[model samples]
Target: MSGNVLSIADRQPEDVQRRAVAAVSLQRWREIEHARVVKKGGVPVQTDQGSDLPASLDAWYRSQPVKPGRISPRLTLTDDEKRAYGLPKSARLIALRGLGDEVDHWSVAVFPVMGGYVVGVKAPAGGGGVGVFWRLSHKASDYARRLSVEHGMLIRERYA
Candidate 1:
């Protein structure tokens, strides 16, 4: 005769098993929803929430060395700028220094907003900030180059 042994889950009450299943389903749904929100450029409504760069770009930026006494500070977008870009309150703007010309030390600020990516040059001593919005990250690099050229800044080799 074959032995019949009840597993721990099988020993649980039917109601408990149903509840466990429902909980797992709900968690999976939440994961899908969160991904959908991020893909749409909206912040996910979860406890772990903040704006960040795409992984590859972030890694590249982090790997670069900053010059002494030239650490770039994280710039805060003004209320008007946030509204214009359709960015949420939690959005973060990053400025990577030493990426621009050696003379002026203009940093490159990049961030993702509700509809697209924003690439800009931090204002030098007496100029206003220059920003360009693009639909794709790759396309934004072109705008970055254009901005550098227009501003007479030479971007560090291989950086956009």
Candidate 2:
């Protein structure tokens, strides 16, 4: 009998090609959403980089799409804002909290920068504002907790 073997490319049927195309489309959509969210100063729940963000921020990020225009701005830290906050260029988001009950209210976010962690707060009006740089994550977390308690807001973890 003659040996008949399907090549690797032949193994991929039209359904697989369709799936691949769909996957690419989904990825493009995600990328666009990620850019929009980041531009608006919001952290994306799922990133190609990885899920180093706290769970709360992840949840908030996931919910943004469901409520389109309600995504609060001024949640991400920019290069200039990082400099003002004394955060390193490698800093990444770890957690976040809203200062008020409304979705458009001011929010605070924590980033793990070199040497330690930094917690920055931003208002809806749009500004870098003030932030506290701590030598430890726990200390930064404690401060965030205190702020949450004081403002009667709920804080959520984005990293661990």
Report the lDDT tens digits of candidate 1 across residue range 1-160. Answer: 8999989999999999999999999999989977997988786655422244322223324445556786543355554345444444555554533324433555555545567666766545533243445677777667567656655665433333
For every model shown, what is its TM-score relative to the native structure?
Answer: 0.27, 0.32
Give per-residue CA lDDT, model 2, range 1-160, as digits (tens).
Answer: 8998987756898899788889999999988977997888776544223234323432323333334565343345555444443346655653233322223455555556568766655344442334556787787888677656544555534442
lDDT score of model 1?
Answer: 0.55
Name model 1 segments beyond 4 Å from true: 47-160
lDDT at position 68, candidate 1: 75
TM-score of 1: 0.27
lDDT of 1 at 132: 47
Among these predictions, the greatest lDDT belongs to 1
Q: For all the candidates, what are their Cα RMSDs to the real structure?
A: 16.3, 17.6
